[model samples]
Target: MHVLELAKRRKTVRKFLPDKPPKEDILKAIKAAKEAPSGMNAQPWKFVVVDDNWLKAKIREACEREEEKFYSHTKGELIAWLNAKGFKPEKPFLSEAPYLILVFGHTKAPYWLHSTWIAVGYLLLALEELGLGTVTYTPPNPKPIKELLRVPNEWKLQTILPVGYPADPKPKYERKKLEDVVSFNEF
Candidate 1:
C-alpha cells in the first residue's frame, strides 16, 4: 500500500475482536520495530508481549485505580482536553485485547526514550499493514507495572499497545493542516 494511504487508513482503535492474531504476525511487527534507528545503534528498547488473561486482568485493575485517581485529581485544561477526546478513566481494552505490548526503554542510555518511541512508531505502521489495530496507552504509574511484570530495574516502562482486530468503526478526527504543523528550515 502507498505510504500516504496506509497512514490515512490507520487509526487508534480501542474496541477489538476477541480473536487472537497469529504469533508470527506479531513477531513480524516487532521485527520491523526493532529495525528502527537508534542513537549510536544502541537499540535500547525491549518489548514485552502479554497475552495471558490473568495478567491482563491484573494490569487492568491497577491501571483503572490510577486512572480514577488521575481523573479525580487532574483539572482544568488537561481535563478539558481529555473530555474533548471522549476519554474516560475506564480501560477495559487492556484486558479485552488479545495482546498487550509493553514497550520498555533503557533508562541509563542517553537517547533510549526517543529511540524506543521511534520503534513504537514503526511498530504501529507494521501492525496496520498486517490488518491489525491498536491503541497506544500510557499508564498513570509505572511502579505497579514494573512489579507485576517483573521488569528489570534498569528498564523503564514507556508505552502499552493493546493489539487485536478492530471491533470499533473508524472515528472521524480533524487533524491540523500540513502548513499548520510544518515550518521551513528557518522557523
Candidate 2:
C-alpha cells in the first residue's frame, strides 16, 4: 500500500480476532520496526512479546488495578477526555488479543531519550501494512507490569500493545485539516 493509504488504514484496534498472526508475519513486523531511524543509531527499543495465558491474565489484572483507581477518583473532564480518546477502563484486549507486546525505552542510552517512539511508530505502521491490528497504551502506572514481566528496572515501559487481526474493518476518524495545525515556518 502507498504510505498515505497505510497511514489512513492504521487505527487503534479495540476489538481483535482471536487468532494470532503467522510467525513469519509477526517476525516481519518486528523486523520492520527495527528499520526505524534512531538518534545517532542508538536504536534503544526493546520489545517483550507475551503470549502465555497466565502472564496475559496477570498483566490485565495489574493494568485494571491502576485503571480502577484512576477511574474511581478521577472525575469531571479527565474522565471524559480519556473516554473520548478511546481509553477503555477495563482492557479485555490485554487478555484476549493473540499477542501482547511490551515496548520499553532505555533512557540511559546515548543522547536520544526519545528513540523508542520511532520504533513504536514503525511497528504500528508495519502491523497495519501486514493486515494486523494493534492497540497502543502507555499507562501512568507501569511498575507492577514491569515486575510481573521481570523487566529490568533500568528500562522504561513506553507502552503495552495488544496485537492481532481486527474483528471488524471500518473507516476510522479522519484527520483535521492541515491548515488548522500548521503555522508555516513559525508559530
lDDT of 1: 0.92
Q: Which ranges of candidate 1 are over 4 A from the true structure? A: none
Clashes of each: 0, 0
Query: What is the overall TM-score of model 2 with all chains considered together?
Result: 0.91
Model 2, CA-based lDDT = 0.85
lDDT of model 2 at residue 108?
A: 73
The global C-alpha lDDT for each of the candidates, from Candidate 1 onward, is: 0.92, 0.85
Best candidate according to TM-score: 1
TM-scores of the candidates in the order shown: 0.95, 0.91
lDDT tens readout by residue for model 1, 14-64: 999989999899999999999999998999999999999999999999999
Error of 2 at 6 (Å): 0.3
lDDT of 2 by residue, 1-187 (tens): 8878898888878788878888678789989888888888988889888889899999999999998887888879988898887666798988998888899987778644467888888899999999999888876699999888788877889999898899856567688898989987798
How many backbone overlaps does candidate 2 show? 0
Candidate 1 Cα deviation (angstroms), residue 79? 1.0
